[model samples]
Target: MKIERIEEYDERFEKDIIDQHGAYVINDETYAFQVLDRDTCRVTFSNRNDLNEAIEEYRFFGGHISCFVDQNGKILKEYDKVSFFDMKLEDIYVSQFYVSEEKIKRLLPYVKEFLIPVAKIDGKMVSLDGHTRMKIAQLKGISHVNCYYEEAGDYAKDFMEEAQQRGIFHVYDMPLLSKEEYEEKWHRFCDDFFEQRKAL
Candidate 1:
């Protein structure tokens, strides 16, 4: 739950990764996957409905959450930095949706337990979850936050291994986006997604 807010981006690393491998990079030393752009969220959940569902279940594993208070009595939340790119955005048409900002604002006063997910690595705290809550806190100008640390483990490796054992290949693994496809499709997908959310 305790995470450092990013003050800037390493444009150099981002450029290098995009130019060299068509991937986006996070400067692990100082950056976080804090940008919650629709594209990035789509990439994270892309073609991974099972994982998205798993995340939803995992989110409530514990009924209680811890909060941190700054000297000014402000509540803080946890946020993490992550990487994003085109390959990551493929087949993301059916991922889970995000919590509405209005909902968060409305529930803030009644929230008794606020969860901020983090990984503890050799005494250093790193964010593993709760981007939406953190963004809400930032918008509210509440700078105090806290979290419970989970031991560092190879979650991605373990998840993928289990997936491979079960013969699960996400849709994104199949093919690269043709330039025409990206131009004609991705934007429309985003537009449709927002419209649907608005209707909801």
Candidate 2:
């Protein structure tokens, strides 16, 4: 993924109805807009400088912006309280890794194929580290679900710890592997994981 330095926040109005609000702002924006049918509002700033400035403003103001939007896309006078912890799947980055075809064939029958639970960080939605599961979810028209706000560094460490604890050293943290190595090993692990699951 392309990492750009953020500088300001750009605010724009949406023409959608707020159906169910999520727990937190998915990104570093003041308003976290969640609309009906699982659609979300994306804020586009002119540049990274402006984006960073906006983020800083939001952080200074208590790390959140809460408001209620009506069906006509109007923000109601009453402010809704939202926490930073209530992040969505869209906010996180997807690691570049390949899912094995064998795993897909094996898990296809047993897995629920909807809203695959990825990783969670302190109870908030984070990244879709599982490439195979994400692809499957998309193919099936299922929402990719996860918890929020985990630093990439911290996530790398946690992933390593979990793998080591579970004796899954073969599937090491993505950061530790070279891009090519990650692709090969991830595919192998995906196949083996589903194969074991099927055996049970």
What TM-score does model 1 achieve against the real structure? 0.27
- Note the clash tally of each candidate: 7, 21
Cα lDDT tens digits, model 2, 15-118, are 22111122122244333333222122233333343444443333332222343344465544332333233323344334333445544544465444223223
Question: In order, what lDDT does every prediction score?
Answer: 0.34, 0.38
Q: Estimate each model's TM-score.
A: 0.27, 0.28
Clashing pairs in 1: 1-147, 32-81, 32-82, 33-81, 33-82, 76-144, 76-145
Candidate 2, residue 9: the lDDT equals 29
C-alpha RMSD for every candidate? 19.5, 17.9
Clashes of 1: 7
Error of 1 at 15 (Å): 44
